[model samples]
Target chain A: MSLPLLEVDDLHVTFNTASGPVHAVDGVSFTMESGDSLGVVGESGSGKSVTARALLRLFAITDDVRIAGSVRFDGVDLLRIDERKLRDVRGGQIGMIFQDPLTSLNPLMAVGEQIAESLRLHRGMGRSEAAAEAVELLGRVGIADPERRATELPNSFSGGMRQRVMISLAIACRPRLLIADEPTTALDVTVQAEILLLLDELRRSEQMALMLITHDFGVVAATCEDVQVMYAGRLVEKASMVHLFDRANHPYTEGLLRLVPRFEDAHTGRLHPIAGQPPITGGGGSSCAFAPRCSHAFDRCRSEVPPEVAVGPQHLSACWLAAERAKDATEAGRPWKRDP
Target chain B: MSAAAARAVLEVSDAVVEFDTDGGRITAVDGVSLQLSTGETLGLVGESGCGKSTLARAILQLVPMQQGSVRLEDTDLGSLSPRELRRMRHRIQMVFQDPRGSLDPRMSVTALIGEPLRVHGIGDRASRAREVAEAMELVGLPALVADRLPSELSGGQQQRVGIARAIVTDPAVLVCDEPVSALDVSIQAQIINVLDELRDTLNLAMLFIAHDLSVVRHLSDRVAVMYLGQFVETGTASEVFTEPRHPYTQGLITSVPRADTESAARLQTARRLVLGELPSLLDPPSGCRYRTRCPYATDRCADVEPPPDLLDGHHAVRCHHHRAITAGEHQPSSKSMRG
Candidate 1:
């Protein structure tokens, strides 16, 4: 097989807190092909966003932070790159859109100038050419009357429009990969759909890979072709979107799926929530991180960390009881259905 | 007023809330009329700036209503004096969206829940502690957590403490304004289940307000869909979810990503969304607020406001072209569904 467009191997990120060193990202790994959309899903502080930021080297590396990993993009190891080279690759070759658009864009600059600034810096285009490109990009993202809206500040746009502007700026450099961190969190449901669609269209048209970091499974199902489920700073499950949704092997994945409210399901009794909260990560990472929250956890699960086992083609789950559950389902004549 | 057999714990008649901003006087809640019977759960679903939160606040008298009246049981909320209102406030409580911001950091869980009862002079010291313990138990928090500060607990636990504080007074009406929006999905479900169990055990009347229809659909008996400042549609949960009348309602239902759906096309086709954004509430469109985004909008829609037309005994919609829109005759060539 050809090398992945972006390959992450044995990534480990830790932060030194007063309590101890928090193992935020523990040996998390994934690979993405060109134009492939991969979703990194987890609850808050699951280390999903931190892992994304690590790809861009956003975290400070002092005596506090200890980052050891290999992140290869276009055959270049991002971890080994110097600050100057990393800066060039950060926004030019790889753009990022943050959760809050209001804070992401500069309040002092006009919305259009922000987009043009990226274009001028990265593409080395003339001022007039960059300005024209900025307006065109604004129009492309579904902003009406781009010329007038371009001159307006970020405060002038609504939450949805500001997000569109952020997306416009991110894509202005035509980066090979776009890392969007909870891009739709601040927007309403209708506006969320619109922004997702816009991103989808841009990804398809530009053939740019998208790394969407969010906790919403619905958003993951809609946009991502592959998914990685994180729990307590580790990747517990990774699979194609279809397999993850239809035949989720991991207990955590199953719990997450059941947690989301579906439109078709009638209001029965209360929702079946996973018992207990996620554990806080400390330096020591010998035991299974999810053992405290897992109902099916055994003595082995509590004492030893489970290794990632291949459940199916392109599917992996790190849980001791997944095989047992799969066997039980099969014996009960309620086998997991595979998507055609 | 008491003609209906069911006793209403809370009722708002054509309640309107307006805010005076630099732009102008914005009608946040326009002519919204609703009723929450004793022990009943009413879901208020809408987009941001649709005035759902404002309406919830108006019921608790947190925000002063510009017009109409809110009545809790036999008492008129708007006409109550300061002393009377303070006494009545214990009968109604609220849980806001942000648990961290809503809760006092310095206060312990014990103190946070016990403060309301103490303020109301409901019991002595020992009895108040017992009440606090009972409230904590009602929301499924551990007894040990009572001594912990709000900062020591997780987001879900903080919200549970918020719920405990709201219920400590044993309020007849509980108004939850986007209580779970800020929580994670797993934590959100836990909080929602806690709320559901509390309502069942206490027989409490609740106004569950949220921006997501799916969340509200699970908890509410009857759901009201608000657009701009007005309720465009209202009906029983089953009737509204399966058979939405208003175009905006249909669009909202469609916009939500369903687990059963395989493609965005199918989802988009399910609810054909109108192109433009929501018009400004200060200087809204001349006629119906939704007319600006309604696909079946006509010149009549722009000129005269559409009145709420009853589709059935329980379901109602505000649209000039409900007949054609529901019949799917005037639907655009997209994948939007017809009634």
Candidate 2:
């Protein structure tokens, strides 16, 4: 059988700061198959973006930061590859787009030239041919009047337009995977919906895997098929989108799902915000990181780290409750249910 | 109607704010009018460049209006002298979006929260310190963190400090301009809860301006939808959000991704998305400012500005075809609606 498109095993990313070592991503592991669309959902300091950057090894080589893990893309470990080969894998095989497009894109170069350069470098296309294809790429991404818009600088484009340009640039080489980090957070909801539609369309047409990192659950509900929730630099829950919405195994996930006020929800009274704050990372203990904030956390959760337990067919949750439920087969459904 | 009108602590009429740019004169805030009653929250929601913030500034007379009147209780701020305006500052306060950016980094939390009280010269040295500690506790901050700098606090803590500063002088009207947008989801909930509780306790007339529809729907009693510097629709939160009349308002409501499983399943099929981004405020559309991106735009929508069509003196929509659109009589231009 063919290997999964991407497999991340025991990924740990730490930074040695003035205070101590900050464990941004701790023991996170997941697998994605070809053309799979996964959403990495988390809040600030939750290590969602750090995990993505770690996959690309995008951090500058430094003594302060420590990265240890195996990231297998199509059965090959990206960490073992040399810089020359890693460069080919970065833009040619896997493409990345960040939150701010203006910073990611060149301010002085023409928008089309930016895309063309990527195409010429990665695909070895002629300059003139790449330029012609760049216009086509812009049109594919929902940019109107691609020909004229292509010659304009990044500063000339609006936020939404600049994001479209960034997408076109990333997809110029027809990369097998695309990692978009908060791609539409800065745009209006209407523009955000359009960009989401464009990304969904491109994923279908190109059959490319997508790893969309965002903090908004609604955005993930709109696009991703599978959702992975991160908290305190650890993966708390992983499940299909429908199952995650229906039966969130982890308390942290349940808290997030309940707290986020849905515009569609009928007036549900006051929001039940999760009490306490996320703990500081890099304590390096064998305890649950989310125990401090988790409402259902117990003494065991505070003392011992919970292992990934199978809660459903393809669902896994790293909570002691999940392990308890497995031990007692008679106890069905989630241990805790949200108030009606 | 009379009871509500009597309770109105802040009234704005025909508020017009303009800025001169290199391109031309841009009407950032067009002729907009709103009334915020005591203990009532009015959510001002719009995309970027819709001039929601500018309108907030106009209400406080922070920016000079081209031609308008801002009346706080019995006083008209337009006729107030510079000294008089300064004196009136304590009555109405504003909390900004970027908590870290708005707070003075050099000052301690206690000092930051106490600055407004100090500026207004309300209390003596000893009394000011006591009041500062009280405000800090009111926003759920501990007394020990009072000595810490703004940089030491988390985003949520920083925002709490900002809210504390705004309410320290016991302002009657609190204008929060996207106060929780920069925070994380969990912390955003905390800050939102704090704001809601404070509004109830203080009986403050709050204009909670934010682009987040969910948060606005949660905190607001009344909601106003702005497009290209004009109020396209205004009504009770339920009326505006559940039964949106204006096409622009409808688009904004439908654009928010439905989180429920049943509705999310229908997301791909149901397409009432807005056509394009907000048009340039420099040269806004002649008639209905939203006509450029509105799907139900007709010849009348382009030729003449649609006057406000009030429904029972509560809900108002500014669209020529709102009636037809509401009754499902008009068809959106299929070509532009999809893209």
RMSDs, each prediction? 2.9, 2.2
lDDT string for model 1 (B73-153, tens) is 779989989899999999999998999998889999999999999898898999998899899988988998888999999
Chain A TM-score values for every predicted structure, listed in order: 0.94, 0.94
- Give DockQ for candidates 1 onward, in order: 0.61, 0.60
Off by over 4 Å in 2: A61-63, A323-340, B1-6, B262-271, B337-339
Q: Report the lDDT tens digits of candidate 2 across residue range A176-260.
A: 8999999999888877877787788788899999999998888888888899999878898998987777677777887888777
Interface RMSD (Å), each candidate? 1.9, 2.1
Docking class of predicted structure 1: medium
Clashing pairs in 1: B269-B335
Write down the TM-score of model 2's second chain: 0.95
TM-score of chain B of 1: 0.94
